[model samples]
Target: MRCFVTGAAGFIGSNLVDRLLAAGHEVVGYDNFSTGQRSFLEGAGRSAGFTLVEGDLLNPDVLRPAVAGCDIVFHLAANADVRFGTHHPFKDIEQNLIATFNVLEAMRAHGIKKIAFSSTGSVYGEAAVIPTPEDAPFPIQTSLYGNSKVAAEGLISSYCEGFGFQGFIFRFVSILGERYTHGHVFDFYNKLRNDPSSLEVLGNGKQRKSYLYVQDCIDAILIAVERADAKINIFNLGQNEYCEVNQSIGWICDRLGVSPKLSYTGGERGWIGDNPLIFLDCSRIRALGWTPKLSIRDGVVNTLEYLMANPWVLDARG
Candidate 1:
């Protein structure tokens, strides 16, 4: 199968690209390097079946050509930062909502039928249930980033109904693993590496969320695309276990061999529009014969090891 993956230079997108290439599929990678790293895609480009297109999803000309001749489109490009949306709300809307419009238009023009969208767990917005299901009500988003994702999901569903395309929406939880650029774990590790004595957490260290390894996320995408028979299939992609912020901080400290003083900025939500507790019920996806392989502690240790070896976190700070 020929696949066109947006944000293909990003952590999860690049990982998926590698998996597809390994499985003997031709992959055209589309990325503008907005938040994605070039090194991630460069490593995958070494493979014979991978092609990289330097382009933005906001531009129809770029998207149309990049998506041409692709059997499946994995739309992962977006303004993924939660805090950034607080300061620059329009940035999220433009990158996520407007960019998705361009992708849909391009797909419609080219008659591309299948799209595996990278939605967010933020769309659930402080779920009343511990493990929120796909049927859970989507409240009005607290952050513009979440709202933009909700809008994008709606657009994809509209396209699926109106244009006869298959749309797979995977609302992802906290994703941590190789090639990760930003997140709570990365922030915690960087703080400890710089000042091991005092660690400044963004919020009160009580916020709880589910963490999923990048491999598991990619696996869910593959499973959804292969088995989805619905016109619009939505799945919550996350680990079954939930980890508190302080617990995750302790895990990082233990892995780094540092006993740091923990400080907090005071609040349940780490940042504006940040959901305090996010635990997704992934039984919907698990019922499809896919389950997360790495536990929370295992995933954190693996990420810490990767950070130590690659030194991307140090470079990211500098």
Candidate 2:
């Protein structure tokens, strides 16, 4: 199969590109290097089956033609800056919501009937349910990032219903593994590297969150795309277990062999749209015989190890 993946140079996208190539599929990777790293694509560049296109999704003239003659579209590009969504109000809509519209329109123009989107668990927004299910009712959106994803999910489902398209929507918890550039793990590691004696944590450090390794995330995506045949298939991709923010800190500190003085700004949530707890019920995907190989602790340690080995990622991100 010929696969077209957006955000192809990103952490998860680059990893997925390598996997698809290994599975004997031809892949065309589309990316704008705004937050994507070229170094991440070194492995993909070696593959004869992989083609890289440099363009932004907001430009349909570029995106539409680039998407031509593709079997499936994996729309993974988006503004995932949830913590700073309020600072730049229009960033989420233009980068996420409008960009998704463009991708859908491009797919429609090119006769592409199948799409897999990277949605987020943030869309749940402080749910009343603990382990939120795929069918759980969405509460008020707490962040602009989540709001945009919610809108994008609706658009994808509508396209499936109105245009005979097959859509796979995976709402993921925080992903951790190699090529992890952003998120709490990256932030904490970067700060600690600079100042090993002190570490300032956000909130009260009790935020319980579930995470999935990058490979495990891609596994669920491929499985769902292959087996699930609904017009709009929605699955929550996450570990069944979760860990507290403080517990994860212990793991990171233990691995780094540094005990920094911990100080916290007294609050229940980290940021404006931060949910205090995020534990998704992934039984739907688990029923497909897919399970994450790494626990939250393992994932965190692996991510830190990657950062330590490749300090350039920290310098580049900074």
> Candidate 1's residue-wise lDDT over 106-219, tens digit each?
988898999989999999887777789999887766888889999999999999999999999999997889887778777787777778999998889999878899998899
Q: All candidates: CA RMSD in angstroms?
A: 1.2, 0.6
Q: Scored by CA lDDT, what does every candidate get?
A: 0.88, 0.94
Model 1 TM-score, 2 decimals? 0.97
Candidate 2 Cα misplacement greater than 4 A, ranges: none
lDDT of 2 at 283: 94
Candidate 2, 198: how far from true, in Å? 0.5
Give lDDT for model 2.
0.94
Instruction: Indicate the worst ten consecutive residues by lDDT in candidate 2.
Output: 287-296
Question: Highest lDDT, which number?
Answer: 2
Model 1 poorest ten-residue lDDT run: 309-318
Measured against the true structure, the TM-scores of the candidates, in listed sequence, are 0.97, 0.99
lDDT of 2 by residue, 71-187 (tens): 999999999889999999999999999999999999999899999999999999999988999888999888899999999999999999999999999999999999999988999
